[model samples]
Target: MSEKIFSYLEVHAVDHCNNNCRWCNNHSPFCPEREYAAGEYIPWMEKLEKKGIEYDMISVMGGEPFLHKNLTGFVLELRRRFPRKSLAISTNGFWLGEEQIESYQMLWKLTDILFISLYPNLLRGLKDGGDVTPLLHKITKHNPHLKIDLRQKQTFRMIAYSEEPVEPNTFCGTSECTTLLADGRLARCGLGGYAGYSPNVGEAFRSSKHMFFDLNRKFSKGEFWNWRRRWPFDACYHCDSYKWRETNWKAEKGKRRRLDLELEHDRLAGGRLMALGNFTQAESLFRRTAEKYPLDAALCNDLAVCVSHREPLEALAYLAKALEIDPDHDDARANLRRLRHVLGRGTENARPEVCSADAGVR
Candidate 1:
């Protein structure tokens, strides 16, 4: 049987983040945009509830979910509406002090999980110190019954870039990976906004009156998993220990301003080589270019695909490397799935039989 594709909901309460970590991919501190107001949330919640769409899991994230003044109220409302549904939140955990903890007490009663971003630099007092470990431990200790995942920065992953892409890494490719922006836009994965594309979540939801309409339109019919375009990396992608390249979209000034230019050059060169079906040479060029700019997920993804036929094991290695850098890498994940199946069927030793004239590594 095919895998069941479960649907989940993510609501971005606010886009204005408080932390100013150097590796922040969305450039949170630099993001001068704010998405929603407290009043806006209730209506959306009501709409979802009226539709009888009980989300498998409702994920609350933002520049920081706790940044919202009504965070506690929001959690309570959600719990009140969907008593049996799972609730989760991702936060920098900076405001998680005594008062905040007390406020969260009500939330903890309903929340099933809490994902705290343990960015070393985001700790308190140590330049970018905003340690959440103590807070996380405290929450867990107090609740004792709550489940928590202390997500380190290294666990994130990225897809490969087409030009100088970065190495892959390990990640859990959740079947229900999806995100909902404050504007009600839906994306295939959590990193969609960071990756530079709008999956039109809000428009889909408003038009159809059902969240599944957007989900089915984007996944089943839209083939949302395919990565054919290019986008820069965000803080989550950069903080990922497995990441290789970094795109400073905010830096549009001097010598460093032309970073995208360098990436573009490599992309063009890499594309030409790939067009000739020269996987070996293309892989070599991509490897060298990626070394200088390791954050390009698209490039890394391409190199992995090129070498898959010639060297399945090597290709698997490259795909794994690409995934390490970008966990949301749909292509790398798909390719890795295929490679694993090929290797498992004991076809690793089998060679394709081709006519001599047509067999020239076509």
Candidate 2:
């Protein structure tokens, strides 16, 4: 497949998992609205082909990939698109149905490897009295050519919930993991993407590394190779397994969470003021909110927005603060450039469309 753009590609056919393992690596059990349409993968495939991004080994995973009705169709499409790429599916093996045996056989034919993570929680619901041996025999009897790997025990370390944010760990397996999410976001790892942590807070993905790429978007091949050589994404520090070997591996109390209540309130109040055409009150609220959460880039950017027209210097200060907090904040950077033009600092550029008194500040 054109020498492979990536070493491995993890394609999640569905986000929500059927079995609730204590610590699913991707946290599939806790994922909400986990299902993906069979058609969702087509555009992504098209984009990959258009960009010439290929993978040597593609892992089709999910809460359980078998849960998706059109999984075989998706697999067929993968084969059709990239015939040389080796395909594999990681499943919990709990929900095999009598009606879908043929579909399973077809999937086995298309895929090169099948990894069944045999969790006890899934064993309870097995139709064959919780015995995986008979199921394995049955599956092999159907397609002897398929290579099956049965993992009775967990492979990776588990990250548990904690009351507060934990320190960044350095030894995570996800450093090598690249996940192509169902919604077309090519994330560095599943933990950073699915957990919904803020990039600025250091618990989530790096603003520069992990991003949502559209179908027509151009990716830097050199950057991709450079990132591949890097051991871990900056987001890995937020994970418990970052340096599992060195750290005292103890299950701590509490969960990974983000605290943003005060900031939300202030932003909402300011938004209402802006909507009501009360720029003065909006600016005051934004300023107070920015002071309360100086580290929050959104608040700083909002404050800059409020003061952009009436107080250009104050707006520049607030924008600068926002940039300091999040250097990758696009809106703040764009506004800074726009405000500079209004002040005629960099170039003798014409006044922006919104420089007039009646222009919308938001």
**TM-scores of all predicted structures:** 0.45, 0.57
Model 1 lDDT-worst window of ten: 227-236
| Cα distance off (Å), candidate 2, residue 325 | 58
Query: Against the correct fold, how does model 1 do in TM-score?
Result: 0.45
Candidate 2 lDDT tens digits, 245-278: 3322221123221124335534655665676677
Model 1 spans with C-alpha error above 4 angstroms: 1-4, 21-27, 33-55, 96-99, 124-137, 154-176, 194-362
Error of 2 at 324 (Å): 65
Candidate 2 whole-model C-alpha lDDT, 0 to 1 = 0.61
Worst lDDT 10-window in candidate 2: 250-259
Best by TM-score: 2
lDDT for 220 (candidate 1): 34
